[model samples]
Target: MTAMHHLTTPDGIRLAYADTGGTGRPLLALHGAFGRGRPFLSLADRLGPDWRIVAPDQRGHGRSDRAADYGREAFLADTATLVERLDLAPCVLVGHSLGGLNAFQLAARRPDLVRAFVVVDMAAELPPHDSDWLDGLPETYGSLDALRTEIEARVSLGEPLHFLEGAVETDQGWRLRWHPDDMREVKRQVFGEHWADWYASDQPALVLRGGASPIVPDDIARRMLDRPNTRLATIDDGTHDFYLTHRTRFHDAVAEFLTTL
Candidate 1:
């Protein structure tokens, strides 16, 4: 079972997170864009009675408050506050896509806080995709069933969670979590060339790529492996949202990676 908690950042934004009970080293799990802490539920449970897993809903996603601005520095600062507030000793930070970017930036800024890191299905350089594609999602899914069908079809194609689409049930009916303008802004910040320079340190990091994912291509994966103590693992038939669609497999891979620590 997992328990929910709130951590108030220095700026007073309430961040929601889930903490699962366990004994050994603590691991912080960060979800990708369009994802919340809940999706990692199964994976945390599967890690068994050894590691304590903390998954947080980043600002502007899930139960967290949406601030006027959302950027990598803001997210990283919020995470740092969380780590200090919780008094969690050095931890293994697992980040997916957007989450992954935050983790790297945090480590680059404060290397002593993290013992190791795991990046899932993302690379320093993001693939070329039109911002118009994201702008079109609000009009794409008319109903929940349509959204579900779209998910299934794209899951069939091995697209991951961040790339699939976003829709949530609200009083206003099906709505998206982000504004198109924020989406474009955040996307550019994350995909820029500076992201690679941030990972220049010699830290132990694991980069997991979904076998059929386009987000993190083969060449990029190999480049990440070139980093200090970085290892690459590919889950066959997995997509961007590997944890949600292939929970057991994704969790198993994470567990295996932890075992090496």
Candidate 2:
């Protein structure tokens, strides 16, 4: 079962998170853009009783307070505070997309806090692409079904409907829990070159790639694998959100890796 909790950052923004309560080793799981902590629920379950999974809704996403600052420094500070405040130092860090970038940087800046790392479908050098869809997102939907339809239309081909996990029903109608403007700003900061951070830490790392993903190209994955003690695995039919789409394969890969550590 999952329990909800809140933590106030030094900046005073209240961040919401979900924890799979147990006495097992801590695993800090972070979601990507347009995603919240709840989607990790299945992965946490699959990890069994050995892992006490903690998934947080990063600032300006999910139930967390939307802050004015969407800079890279601000996001990193929030992760550091969460790790420090919760006494989760030396915990395993699992992140997807935007969260993956944050995880590697955190591991670089505060190596003492991260024991191991799992980065899904992200690379140091992200290819530039138009994000006009983010700016064109509708502010509100007439109903949940309407929102689902829109989300289904936008998601990549073959991705499950669960990718819309970030959507929530509000009194005003249905809408995304995160603000589009905030997401756009965060995206702006997320882009650009970041190879230094990716290669900074030699900590045991796993770079999971979706065979069909365009974000983390084959060459980048190969370079990441060149790091000592790091390994690369690809889910043949998986997309960017393969953890959700191919849970069993993803979990097995993670489980096998953890056993080696």
Candidate 3:
């Protein structure tokens, strides 16, 4: 069965997600900072019938609760709670950007809950991409298309949105679902600490980077290769949003990685 719904977190916060029940290993897919899990529906479809996919809309995204103090730990804690609540056995966690960092943190803290990790288009350490003013962006828009056009036009020139997949329309507007306040806090937490220095996961981890993304430097990607059980790959014609911009190549990399596990 295919379903999209909401689940309450440890602290009673409601988080939204998409769940597809099937036969193989259980896979949890987390979206980027200002992202919703639905954007990954195409990926889940292409993965075939071998896997059950669970894609969660981060705490402040999609149809979930929009509360204050929504930061990295809140999202991570909520993910851990969902895993325990659903009892996703032999789970393989797949994540992108901010989601990648949460996956690493979860595996590091609760190693037994995770079998492996697919880190998509995110490095342990990423340089800033002029995302500072994103929080202050106005939520009010005259029209949905106008909002999307503005966002797409503005973000296309930036580092991450240059590679996003499809856009969705909402009652408020057609902009990305990410809550601005939460987004600001999420960025602060992600760049606040050096990832390599803080992350310690022994499970198999794959780091996929976008060949076209300027946010991740070659040196940083190279240094990430030094980690144990961690291999690296790059997707051409893709920026930070490789899964959406280059679906076939992205799925190939993930499918190949799953086979090894």
Candidate 4:
């Protein structure tokens, strides 16, 4: 079982997280964009009682308060505060997509706080896509199904419904937990030269790639191995959201990696 908690950052944002208490090793699980802490409950259960998974609704997402700054450093600072405040330093970090990038960046700068990290389906450098998709999105949808249908039509491909996992249904209507403007800006910040950060840390690491994912290219995934003490694994039929779609397989891989530590 997981317990929910809240903390006020120096910037006064209310960050929310779920802590699955256990007698085993702690794993800080960071979800990708449009994800929240609640879903880690499924992962914690799947990993069994051998692990404590702490997942947070990052700044401007889920139950957390919105932030004016959506840059990489801002995200890093939020993760740092959660780690230090929860006394989770020297623990493992398992992040997906945007969360994965945040994990490695933190490990690079604060090795003292991170024992090891797992990057799931995220490349050091993000691939670019058109932002026109968000140009005319409505502020709210009449219902969850309505939002899903609308977003699905616009997205055309990939996991469009995944975005609804972080959506909020208020009295007004169903809307994303975060603004499209924030997501767009953050996505923009993600596309850049990050090879330096990728190679900055020598900490033990595991890079899990989705076999069917178009996010992390083969060349970059192979280059990721050049960093010392890193291993790469792939889930053959997996896609970017394989962790959710293939929980058992993802859990097995994560469990196997923990044994090495």
TM-score for all predictions? 0.85, 0.95, 0.88, 0.95
Q: Against the unseen true structure, what C-alpha lDDT does each candidate score?
A: 0.73, 0.84, 0.73, 0.85
**Candidate 4: tens digits of C-alpha lDDT, residues 67-171:** 888899988999999889988888899998889999999999989889999998899887687778888889998999899998888874347645777778889
Residue 5 C-alpha lDDT in model 1: 92
Best by lDDT: 4
**lDDT score of residue 190 within candidate 2:** 88
The ten-residue window of minimal lDDT in model 3 covers: 157-166
The C-alpha local distance difference test score for the whole of candidate 3 amounts to: 0.73
How are the candidates ranked when ordered by lDDT, highest leading?
4, 2, 1, 3
lDDT of 1 by residue, 14-109 (tens): 999988756757888888776787677666577766777888888877778777668777888888887778776578888988888877777778
lDDT of 2 by residue, 1-261 (tens): 577899998888999998887788888988887788787767666778888889999998888999999898898899988889888889988888889999999999999999998998888888566556665778789987888887777755335354467677778877787887887788888889898888899889989889998877888888788777898989988888888888899888888788878
Measured with C-alpha atoms, the lDDT of residue 29 in candidate 2 is 86
Residue 136: error of model 2 in Å? 3.5
User: What's the true lDDT of residue 41 in model 4?
Assistant: 68
Give lDDT: candidate 2, residue 231. 89
In Å, residue 60's CA in model 3 sits off its true spot by 0.6
